[model samples]
Target: MSAQVIAIDAMGGDFGPRSIVQASLACLSATPSLHLTLVGQPSLLEELLSGQSAADRARLTIMPASEVVTMDEKPAQALRGKPDSSMRVALELLRDGKAQACVSAGNTGALMALSRFVLKTLPGIDRPAMVAAIPTQKGYCQLLDLGANVDCSAEHLLQFAVMGSVAAQTLGIARPRVALLNIGTEDIKGNQQVKLAATLLQAARGIHYVGFVEGDGLYRGEADVVVCDGFVGNILLKSSEGLAAMIAARIEALFRKNLASRAVGALALPLMKRLQADLAPARHNGASFLGLQGIVVKSHGSAGVQGFQSAISRALIEIQENLPERLHGRLGDLLS
Candidate 1:
C-alpha cells in the first residue's frame, strides 16, 4: 500500500509551529506509512525541525505559507484577506489532490469557511456540521453540529443524523442507535424543529432512530450518535469540558490539602493519572467538519502537542476509511 500524505497547518493554534512540528515528527515516527507536509513559514518550521533525525526529517516536507488566520479573525475577512494563510494553503493541498486530508488548529470559523469554499460540500449536503467523539459510560458517542451551523431547520437536523450515523459506522459501530438531543426523552418534548426532525429521522431509510436524549443522557451512552443544532451542541460540549476540568482540579486540590492527604495522593497517583488520561480534553481534541468533499479535522485553538497529534490521527483514520466517499453514498439513500 502507498503512504498516506497529510498536510498540517503548523502556524495555527496558541503554541504556533513548535507544537505542530513536534506532533508531526511524533506521528511520522509512530506510523511508518505516514508522510506529512507541514505548512507555515519555512524559516520557523525549519528551526523547529532542526533537532529531528535525518530519517525522520525525510518523511516530512515543508510548505511555505506567508499569512496566518488569527483566533479572533472573522471568517469572511480571513478568507478574503489571507489567501496564503497556512490554513488555506493546507486546504488547497487537499483541493488539488496533493494530500489525502488536512488538519488545523486555526480559527474554527475561518477553517470551516475556507474548507467549504475550497473543498465544497458533498452533493446532497447543504451545509457541513462539526462532529466529534465524546467520552461516554459505554465508551464514546459521536455527536454532531457542534458549533458549525448555529441555526438549522428540520431538514438540517435530519441531515446531521445521517452524517453522524455514517461517521459512527466508519468508526466501527454497525447500525448506530441515532437520537435527537432535547429537553426530555418524551416524544412530545422539544420545539418544532426537533420534533419535525424526529419525525423525519424515523421515516429516513437507513438510520435506526432511537428518539430523544436529554443532556444527562449523553454521558450515560443512551445513543451511539446524537444530533443537535450547533448552538446547543457547542454549549453542551463546552459545559461538559468545563465540568470535567473543575472535577479534575478539585481532586488535585483535595490531594494536596495536608500531609496525610499528600501521602494518600502519592499512593493513589497512578490511579489518578489513568483517570486523568481518560478524561483529558486533549485525547478528544479533534472534530471533523462533516459533509465536506474532502477530510478536514479541526483541533482546538489552544491544543498542545499531544492534542494536535490526536487531531492528525483523526484525519488519518478518516482518510483511510474514505469517510467522504462513504458519506456521499449513504447520503444518497438517506436523502432519497
Candidate 2:
C-alpha cells in the first residue's frame, strides 16, 4: 500500500500553523508511515518549523499559498474568490490524490461547502453529514450531522444513522446500537421529521436501530450511534462542551474549599485523572465528514497543541484503517 499522507490546512485554526506545526511533528514521531503536507504561506509555516531538528523538517513539505478563508467569510465567496485559500488548497490535495485525507480547523461551513462542491457525495447519500466521536460513560458515542445539514429530511437522518453506525464500528464497537434523537422515547415523540426518521431507521437494514434517544440519555450510554439533524446535534455538542467545562470548574472549586477537601482531592488524584481522561476532547479529536469521496477530519477551531496532535493521530488511524474504502464497500449498494 502507498504511504498515507495528510494535507493540513495550516492557516485554518485559532492557533493556525503554530498548533498545526506542533501537531505535525508529534504525529510524525508517533507514526513513521504517515507523511504530512502543510498548506499555507511558506514563510509562516517555515518559521514554525525552523526550530525543529533537520530530520523532523525533512518529513514535512510546505506548499505556499497566500490566501486564507476567515471564519466569518461566507463559503460561496471564499470558494469562488479565494482559490488559493488554505482550506480550498487542502481539499484540492485530497482530490488530486496527493493525500489520503484532509484536515482543517477552519470555518465548518467553508470546509463543508468546499468539500461538497469539489469532492461531491456518494450516490444515494443526499447530503453529507459531520460526525464526531463524543466521550460517553461506557465508551465513545458517534454523534452525526453536527452542523452540516441543519434542515434535514427523514432520509438524511437515516443516512446519518448508517454513516454513524459504520463510524462507531470502525472505532472498535461491534454492531453499534443506533438511536434517533427525539424529545422522548415514545414512538409518538419528536416532530414530524424525527418521527419519520425513527420509522425509517427501524425499517432500515443492516443496523441495530434502538428507537429514539433523548438528549439526557447520552451520558447514560443509551446508544453508540446518535442521529439528529445538524441544528440539534450542534446545539447538543456545544451544550455538552459547556457542561463539561462547568463540571471541571466545580470540581476545582470543591477541591479548594478547605484543607480536608484538599487532602481528599489529593487522594482522588487517580480517579480525577480517569475522569479528566474520559472528558478530554483530544481523545476524540477526529470527526469524519461522511459521504465525501475521501476522509476529511475537522478538529475544533480552538484546539490546542495536544488536541491538534490528537487530530493528526486520528487522521492517521483513519487512513491506516482504509476508512473510505470500507465505507464505500459497506454502503456502496445502498448509495447506488
Candidate 3:
C-alpha cells in the first residue's frame, strides 16, 4: 500500500476535537498506509489518544493549533482573525505538501474562504466549488457548488459541471453523465444562466453532458453529476437532509403507535433499519472543494464519528485519484 497523509482540522466542528480524534483513530486503524496529522490544541488531542495502544497511534501525529473556528463566525473573521486556527493550519499542511489532503468538519463559509486564501485557485479556475456524493435510488450522484459560490455566472456553472464530472469519475463513474440542475428538463425551462450553461456543456469536450435534470430526476440518479449555483445546491441538499429525517421519524412514529403496530414493526425492523441508513444524509458527509490547487474536503459540522470517518474516506479517495492534478489536466479541454 502506498503511504498517504491527511491533515485533520480537529477543532473546527460543532462536536469539536473529541469526535475528530475518534474518527481519525478509526480511519488510521482501517487504512494501514494512512498517516494522520491532527491540527488542534495539542493537549486535548494528546489526551484523546492517551488511552489508545501504541500500535493504534503508530502513524498519527498532532500539530499544535491554538484557535478554533466557530460555526457562527463570519468567514472573513475566521480568515483574518484566526491565523493559527485549526482549519487554517490544516490547509497550510496541505499547501506545504505535508499531507495529501485535508479533512475538516468546519464552518463551510470559513473553510471556503480560508482554503481559497491559503491554497489559491488552480490556474484557469476562477473559484473552487464544493461537490458531495448525494445518495440516489440507483446509487449516488455527485452534486456541486454546495454553498461555495452562491452567485455564479453561466461560465461558472460550466466550470462546476466539469469539476463535478471529474469528481464523479473519481467515485468510479468512467464517463460521468453531467447535467445542469434546472427547474425543468426542457431546453426552454430555466433562467438565462441554465440555458447558457447547457449550451456550453453540450459543446464542451471531455465530459458526457446529458443536458438538464430536475430535482426529482437528480434523486432518481438520472445523471452522474449535477451542477448548480451554490444557492440552489445548498438549499436542495439541506432540504433533502431534512426530508430524509422527517420520513424516517414518521416511519418510527408509525411503528410506535400501538402494540399491534409495534409487533409488526419488530418483524420489519431490520429492513427499516437498512432503509434508514440508506436515507440518512450524514451517511454521505464529505464534500470536496473542487477547483482548488490542493485536495480539501469539508465534512458536515455536526457529524459524529461515523459521519466524520466517511469524510476521511472521501479524502482518501481523492488523494489516491490525485484529484487536483486531474482537474488541472482536464481544465483546458473542458473550459477551452
Candidate 4:
C-alpha cells in the first residue's frame, strides 16, 4: 500500500505544539508508511523539532498557521474570525487532497463546524455524527452521536445506526449486531423518538439491527453498535469516563493506605497496571466524525502525547479501510 499522509492541528490541544510534535515524531518512527504535516506557528514547531534526527524529520512537514481556536470560543465566531487557525488549516489540507486524514484535539464545536464547511457530508447524510469505541466485556462497542447533534429525530437516530454499523465493519466485525440505546429491552420501551428509530432500524437493509439495548448493555457487549441522540450519548460518555477515573483513584488510595497495603499492592502491581491500561481514557481518546466526505479524527482537547497518538492511529485505520467510501456505497444501496 502507498504511504498515508495525515495533517495534525499542532496548536489545538491543551499542551499546544509540544505534545503534538512529540506524538507525530513517535508515529512516524512506528509506522514507516505514515507521513505527517503539522499545522501551527512555525517558530513554536521548529523549536519543538530541534535536535530531531534527519531521517525522522524527513517524514514530517510544517505548515504555519497564524491563529488558534481556543477551547471556549464559539464555533461561529472562530469560523468567521480565524480562517488561519491551525484547526481550520488542517481541514483545508484534507479538502485539498494534501492529506488523507486530519486529526485535531481542539474545540469540538469549532472543529465540527469547520469540518462540515470544508469537507461536507456524504450524499445521503444530512449531518455528520461523532462515533467512538467504548470498551466492553466481550471487546468493544461502537457508539454514535456523541455530542454532535443535541437534538435528533427518529430518522437521525436511524442514520446513526447505519453509519455506526459501517464503522464496525471497517474495524473487522463481519456482521455487527446493532441496537438502540433505550430505557429497557422490551419491544415497547423508551421515548417516542427511540421507539420510532427502532422501527426504522428493523426495516433498514444492510444493517443487523437487533432491537433495544439499555445503558448497561453498552458495557456488557450485548450489541456491537449502540445508537442514541447526541444529548444522551454525550452524557453517557462523560459519566463513564468520570467513573473510570474515580475507580482508578480509589484503587491507588487503597494501596497507599499503610505499609501492609503497600506490600499487597506490590503483589497486585501487574494486575493493576493491566487494568489501568485497559481503562485509561487516553487509550481510547480518538472519536471519528462520521458521514463526512473526508476522514477527521477528534482527539480529546486535554490529551497528552500518548492520547494524541491513539487518535492518529484511529485516523490511519479509517484511511486504510476507506471508511467514508464504504459508508457512501452502503447508504446509497440501502436508500436505493
lDDT of 1 by residue, 1-336 (tens): 579999999898887888889889999999999999999999988888787789989889999999999989999998999989999999999999989999999899999999999999999899999998887889889888889899999999999999999999989998899999999988889999999999999899979999999988988999999999999998887777677667767777888887678877876676655555445443445889999999999988777888888999988899989999999999998898
Query: TM-score for all predictions?
Result: 0.95, 0.93, 0.95, 0.95
Predicted candidate 2 versus true structure: per-residue lDDT over 143-232, tens digit per residue: 888888989988889888888888887788889999998889998788999999877777777889999888778878899999999999
Per-residue lDDT over 55-76 for candidate 4, one digit per residue giving the tens place of the 0 to 100 score? 9899999999999999999999
TM-score of 3: 0.95
Tell how far residue 184 is off in model 3, in angstroms: 1.6
Runs with alpha carbons beyond 4 Å of true place in candidate 2: 266-284
What is the RMSD of candidate 3? 1.7
What are the per-model numbers of colliding residue pairs? Answer: 0, 0, 0, 0
- Which stretches of model 4 miss by more than 4 angstroms? 266-283
Deviation in angstroms for 223 in model 1? 0.3
The RMSD (Cα, Å) of candidate 4 is 1.7
> Model 3, range 27-145, lDDT digits (tens) per residue?
99899999999999998888988999999989999999999999999999999899999999999999999998999998989999999999999888898998877778888888888
Would you list the C-alpha lDDT of every candidate in the order shown? Answer: 0.89, 0.82, 0.87, 0.89
